[model samples]
Target: MKYVIKTQECGYLFKNGILKKILFAGKYRILSMSGWELKITEMTGKVDTKGLPTELLMEQPDFVSRVVRVQIPDDCIGFHLVNGVYKQVIMEGEALYWNVFEKNEIRLVNVTGTEMTEAQVPAMYRHLIPSRLYKRLSVGEGETGLLYIDGRFEKQLSSGTYFYWIYAHEVSMKLYSLKVQQLEISGQEILTSDKVGVRLNILCSYRITRPLELVQKTDNVANLLYTRIQLLAREYIGGFRLDELLAQKEEIGRFLMKQIQGVQEEYCVEILNTGIKDIILPGEIRDIMNTVLVAEKKAQANVIMRREEVASTRSLLNTAKLMEENKVLYRLKELEYLERICDRVGSISLNGAGSVLEQLAALALPKG
Candidate 1:
């Protein structure tokens, strides 16, 4: 039999079901045996050995000169480049490509005890890499991230995406909010100086100023701040009487800011503002206050009624004195009384009287 291999093709010569040699771009006369064969393949791309031993294939210096061999280590990755351009990513394994026509290169990178940097592998090939081979972290806006490798602090990351290979190291992260956040300490019970129990709800706004210092000082910054505020509130409340605490509810908030000045610095936080939301009194105290208010209002009403009566009496006495000083005024008062009496009586018949006007005047006068 006669076999012809093209200039851009390779021929694998097999004799009795075994590969004998690799033929490249040549013409040869092969015997027509039952188990003899010549497999022709294109040399434009990867060379497929089809389970043939690479050592046996490399024995031919002519075959070795025409192709390139890549042995990717188990802990390393290979980036295949053709004609000075990225073509494919080669995982852990062995690969072979023809170098006769175009230039070929396999960039080997060790993925042990190191992160995946953009310089090591270009950003354009991020999607080409396998997802399981690397770890990804996204730090959103108004937040900062702390990166740790093998339980040791490494560095801080701003708001962006980061990639690291999980080869032989453990990767962990901690996020801290930079914006102001509210903390509510609701229904906290305390005793006043007068032994009065009160429940208070407090709110405070804060933000993390130094995330690294906070992490080093305390395991949880929020918890530390909460405890400080709670203790200060209790101490301030315990010093004031019940009446004073109720009168100066806003004073408690101001006291908190002054007392927590040192603590805020230690915790690496900025205290924006603090306030007392609600002050809950006991049922017994509330009832007593309601009763006292009702009694006070009743007393005020009585005093106002007595004042009005005294004013009315004084006005009457002044009018009587004016009438006594002048007979004309006395006559006018009598006529005024008669006019009022006539309005009430529809009809009247006088038998013992000098004239109707004189008799009416006499009747208007007081009997005493």
Candidate 2:
């Protein structure tokens, strides 16, 4: 029988012959001999057995046996052996894989799947484990969720899935957004309560930019915003004693707008609008204000009357001092008075020059 031997590495082929001989009686033996030597023994014909050579029948060594090192990209699909056997399967998308074998010790083998685009790669990787509690949250525009991995809270994550280590108690969270819409204050759309009327509508929205772990820390931001708005409204609007905001409508509107803007800045939220719907005032307060205004006016009038009286008294005193300083001026004043009295009375009666002298003497004397 003729056989062939093939080496897997060098592909070297060798042919040999197997001879069966009867030694002694009833004993048969098989011996493998070189084909060239057997041919010189005068074999009648070549006998062939369809089988793999003895050297080629040995088992192939494992691909990882001589692997010295390996480098895998982040987004590899799967890896396989050079002998056409699959090794590792990557479940997630956008990953890389590689296998490095020792030089000359084993044949180096590489297996790879299809590649993906850079734009499709996730900014961060999030691992999810089964049987673990996770907080599901919805985020709007300008809002974020707080996630605690182990015990530490992370800042931000691009939009994607995330996982946290399981603990005896699951983490808690409050979901909220950072975008704030200003309330609309218009007469047509005023919000009316039992004591006050407000015209404002708040609209908020947010978008997620990272893989976020939802926990109790996430609740702080939203709570802060709500608390701030409520407190501001109470402090600014409720503190006003004026039942009717319309009386000082313009002033109140401006003040409220400023307060809303301040709150927005504090929370890092965008202020959409701040509006004043209506001014509310109690009837009793309005009447009281009117009465107080009337009383003020009366007091002002009294002050003016007293001032006029003082001015008249001062003028009379000045005139008297000037008359005393000049005797001729006093005589002139007396003559003028007589002349005015004579014009009104049809005639002036006096006992000649004696009567005139007596009148002049009387006028000159100081009256007790």
Candidate 3:
């Protein structure tokens, strides 16, 4: 029998259904009575020995020279790199690849540590790793991530990406927004000093100063601050009459801020600002306040009108006195009046007039 193996492939020579020898690219002649057969395999794939001993195949120097053998330890994984490029992940075991065509190599990685940073496995290669082997966490911008290992807090991580080996232990992450945040405590019903019921809507802006201390102080920071503010608002508002509250609304905010100073220090948070957003009055109280405001405005208008009338009367009296004391001033004033009448009337009838001007002056003068 005769056989030919291509340059890119090798042939597994079998004799009587048993492996005998490995043949590289070439031509060979054998006895037809030997009942020999050949199986062709690609050189780019793993070496298949057909149940033949690997050592037996290695005994052939021709086979050993053209293949690369890999042995992975139990505590380590392997990355297969062909021609300096990543091809696939190699598990913990023995494997063989044909090295006749392309350069074959393996890079080993230790799995003893729980975390695999970018230094260990660059971000470019992270996608190639199996999803089951690692757990990923991404902390977005304006957020702080807390890493926990086995139900215990480990360390704070700023905004970035992280990966942990899941086979090592249980890993978890909690993220909190670090930017200024607002909390609305709305629709709170409380009684004022005068026993007037009102609904208050309060708003507060806060930021986390020391996240570690905050977590130690309370499991839930938002709920704690909300309850504290609510109680303080009720306590402070209860001491002021409804009228006083409406008058000094800003004062209430300052009082609440002062009261929560201790809480802020203990909880490790900075209260930037707080204020009463809205003070919703009862229907009856609202109607009464509207009526009072209208009455006050009307009284102010009436006072202004009376003052103007008094000033006008006094001026008239003073002008009359000046005219009575000086006849020349009185005649000038009469002429001014006559000029105004002439502008309104086109013509005037004169009766027994010494002169037109004298008659016109008499007609323009007021009767005593």
Candidate 4:
């Protein structure tokens, strides 16, 4: 016979064939069951056993007059209720969700009704996923749908290719709110880690297509651009002294800009402005350069000093020659000697002085 069981907990009606003892009698054991068939009497009311078979009265529901409670601590664990049966199913962690959905067999609730190629899936869903998941999806465009790798996007990705996406709710599949393009390299990709400890230099110019204000404060786009340029510059002009770049500033700048442009088609970083940011020179090499510059300056100073000395000597020689060629100069020299001798002599002794004066005059005359 059917029995009407009422309780303050959930009210649920069970058929005789489906009812089974989930817990031992006499103990308030919380039972976990599955595959129990049931119908919703009132969508807004609690669960109760009002029209269930007598055998179904063995257990009490959690709530009888309240709404169904489906609270999950973590969204990573999915939950659903069908036919009064509660089910818990684990989903891809935040990181793997994008890649999980890219697989043909996996399905996402909001991702249906849109056409995508293998290459476009990661790019399309990257922003929709959490940052951790966003980074894990290696998305690339492909024929069937967007191709996604667990971590690396794909093989043979060229430089200058961009991936575009938006939050799922921001726009219909028709438009993308976040558009990221990839820059492809014509040649093979070179790994920087492979060349660690190698001396290098870089120079580059970049321009922002969008307003600078739009970029995040922590993005460090300028610094990153500079670093990449420096890497490329080092690849071409490695081992060059810092002073050498200073000397050949124009040439180095041009070479760096050219190399940056070559990689521009691959990296997708804008080249709004370009320049050499820094030139790293080995400490020993820089000291040597400083020494050479100092030596050069000293040599220049010596040359200047020698020229001034030579000019002074020439002027003195010319003055002496002009004085010897003129009779007025001879008189002046005799007068200068007489003034000095007269000052030293107390009385005039013309008798012997005349002879001394003649000898002095002969001695003072310029040689032929």
Best by TM-score: 3
> Residues 1-368, candidate 4, lDDT per residue (tens digit)?
22222222222433443544322112132223534433323222222344663233434332211223222333232223234233223234321111111211223323322223344343434334444222232323321122223332233222223332222212111111123333222222222323312233333435333322323232445455556664665565444544454667667667766666665434434554354444444577578878999999999999999999999999999878977998788678777878897797676545554555686566567989
Summarize candidate 1's per-residue lDDT along 37-119 as a digit string, tens digits: 88888876687776677888798887899888989999888999899888888997887988878888889877775478878
Model 1: worst 10 consecutive residues (lDDT sum): 348-357
What do the candidate models score in CA lDDT, each in turn? 0.85, 0.41, 0.85, 0.41
Per-candidate TM vs. native? Answer: 0.71, 0.30, 0.82, 0.33
Q: Indicate the residue-level lDDT of 297 in model 4.
A: 100
- Candidate 3 residue 296 C-alpha distance from true site, Å: 1.7
For residue 62, what is the lDDT in candidate 2?
29
lDDT (tens digit, per residue) of candidate 3 on 246-318: 9999988888877776678887888988899999999999999999999999999999999999999999999
Error of 4 at 354 (Å): 9.3
- Stretches off by above 4 angstroms in model 2 are 1-148, 158-223, 235-244, 247-250, 263-266, 270-272, 277-368
Q: Under the 3 Å rule for N, CA and C atoms, how many clashes does model 3 have?
A: 0
